[model samples]
Target: MVDVAQHIRIFDQKPADELVPKRTAAIKDLASKLTGPKDVDGLMKMASNLVAAAKFDKKLPEELAQEATASIKKQSPAFVREGRDLELSTIALLAMLGAIDGGTKQGIIERLNFLSAGVWLGLSFQQPNKESRIEALRVEVLHAARDYVARGAENARERKAPALGAPLKPENTNLGEVVSNLRASVERLNRNAVVDREEIDFLWWSVTKWSSALDGLYDEASAYSAAIAFGLDGGARLRRMPLDVHKHLVLRRIRAAEPVSLAGLIAAVGDDRLRILTKIPDASTARTNPEIFPVMSSLLSGSAPKSASKDLQSVEAWTVRALLEATALGLINQHEV
Candidate 1:
């Protein structure tokens, strides 16, 4: 039998203003407590207290929140040893609470980092021998993040919340190497290659990490690309993922290729491949119809100039091509209801 009553209880009963005068000292005390040894249950209780203190105290110093976020990340590595499933769930809940009520954009991003850490923990559980736990955590974390992190971001945006932060530019992260590594992995997979566990962990972790970053930047289309790469066909069982998530994954995956050249991109993945991979009825019609594929026609016109970074493209063009490539390689598939 299990009870989450303690999980939901108000663990910190201090008045909101109780810590105002000594917030720094209070935060230092909590941070010190975090550094000491603790079991899973103790850690959970401590985490709850940390979150409650912040939630109850609207004026909780931002320093406490930042320290809480950092502490969670530092502690995340223990998930595998301590049992990742429960650890991930608890950490996610605490992180979400902090994120939803956080007063600063940086704070929300910090919590999102914790969610990203949870995703990594789930991936780490993917061992060849432990198929059952791996699959269970995969489904659970995917849906949980979609529900808690993704929808939370969407809802915050819809409400025009100030704490969601100012609009962000894509990080200068050139995903060229990442894409190159993925292409090599696909080739190896095509040849029935048996990769070591380390490679598997690295590749999946890299994909999840980048996808989570894109999600943080609100580049849902590009991020969806990486997500599909991680999931592939069997992952289609993610019932909550939308159908339209199909097209964009392909575009962004290919766009991140090493050379980052427009001509190379076109030559590597032409319009024909795009149509076949996407299963679009008419490639030209889809491209020209701005409603369906805005900026796509211009991208395929051969006259469109490359952005300075070469990895940059209209978010509209990103959806289709990456989906196309991943589908062609048989790594990803269209979402099915």
Candidate 2:
């Protein structure tokens, strides 16, 4: 389903706080959060997601995924390469950093937490043992940078930012020709002969859903999260995930809402963030947005179909609770935007 509300680019730049002592204090607070080990579950979940991201959609072969990841690392410190395998790790890392830049202490802390978790997770999956995890972190920071590169590439492509150019420089040049070719290769590999706007919407939904909570208590995970949830501990594996589940459920609720409009839907959800999501022109602006029909049909009639609660008829609670219930049942993850 199309979300009419636009999304704030994660890379948007905001002015720095002008306070003096407060800024210094914020840095200390952020450091405390990053250097401490208080959130074990968060660390583990982050680790699993990074590993699972290295294996997203179960698409790219394992060895190749590793190589793509490595190539990315050789080029950038964060992500590996484009294509299905590195999608989640790449995007998450970029969005995390892009949003964190010289902001408040809280923002800096949040960014650091995610980054540390990402590094730990990357090591957890690549190393064969715990002892090796530390050893790898010490020895292979540069040797392994696919996840970092992947992050840069995605941010560059989505925001039309300048290229990393020749490998590691993250400034002032567009990777236009490079991004176009990479996108073409990925689509070709998918057997998607023609990637129109709808297809872009589909993949956008697929990738954006990679976000998850650090721990089960506070954060939520989705199919993208589950796909890359595998970690070095080998505790969590990618369970069977139904594609199009979230798209279907969301559209179903919207259609169920009489006199639906993008503005109204945002009003109902009450999430300010929804307003920032990039608009889906192909699916949302069309007469009746007919493109949503097929996607909606698959949801209502699919083998594991579940109906929305009568309570869900309203736009007031667009919490994606139904989807979370499915995640609880192992059908899908909590993909709330």
Candidate 3:
């Protein structure tokens, strides 16, 4: 199994106000440790610890996050030489920091490319294994789709639309006539190949989300937060995650709404095959109009709201709840922002 970062359990029971002073001291201590090492092994271990700590605290200093992001990117080559495990670890670090730093779309894509390579290599080591082969095929399809789009963009650039002589009727017109048509086609294809525009928009929105909470732009924090949630579920041990932070963000919002029973919440979330949790008609109607999907609606809305003090104090609930609290902190940071 892949060794993924674990969310730090410290201060899990503390209120937001009480957590502040502890978080400040912890960051200060971690920052001090960072000053001691520049070696690859040391850096990897330190980064893992830093990420775990990050999962615990939402409002880490922007300058510190930026510094951590740069260090991880710079050390990518060394990590690659180490092995697949380390490379994956490095990618995780970059993904977390990139989101936190509100890094450019190009930066996130670069880390994703590394992730694809690492996953492919890991699967290669397990070749001839039944499960690995099945998983490899899925990765192959994504790669093919990516490549096809890239090729289409290149072809469009190379083969300009046939020049029409003089002014021609609309039926005879080519893409070049509109000026923006060819450019738009190439851009669209490139975007499809490289990344989705909606996701890029979400990344920026997450930056805004974090920035508003921090009283300054701390972009990509939700990306990191999503990663934290995924890691908690040990999803890293299974396969690569699609870069869709919005679904996870919506899940955080559902959690923010505060359900009474943790087990029931997970069960309701499990039935979301088409991701109805993120959609309104399917999930919300359970609250407003419970007859639509009785099983889901009932399970989702059955329990009355419980006070934070009344909620379960188990590790699983605490960590999941903390993610909600961390995200909600940004939403309410106005007078506090």
The Cα error of candidate 1 at residue 327, in Å, is 20
Give per-residue lDDT, candidate 2, residue 158.
31
Tens-digit lDDT track of model 2 for 68-117: 34433443455334543423233333223332332233211233333332
Predict model 2's lDDT versus the native: 0.29
Q: Which stretches of candidate 1 lie over 4 Å from their true place?
A: 1-107, 117-130, 160-337
lDDT of 2 at 62: 46
Model 2 lDDT, residue 282, Cα = 19
RMSD of 2: 21.8
Worst 10 residues of 2 by lDDT: 1-10
Separate clash counts for every candidate: 11, 25, 4
* Tens digits of per-residue lDDT for model 1, 1-337: 1112223222323424432223223323333544232332233233333333322323333443444445444533231222222332333334433333332322132333233223322232222223343234344434443344344333222222122223333682646655665566665454332223323443354344333312232233333233233333212222112223333333334334233233444443443333322333224432432222222333345323342124444423433343322222121122111
Q: Give lDDT per model, in order.
A: 0.33, 0.29, 0.32
Backbone clashes (count) for model 2: 25
TM-scores of all predicted structures: 0.22, 0.21, 0.21
How far residue 272's Cα lies from its native spot in candidate 1, in Å, is 16
Best by lDDT: 1
Query: In TM-score terms, which candidate is top?
Result: 1
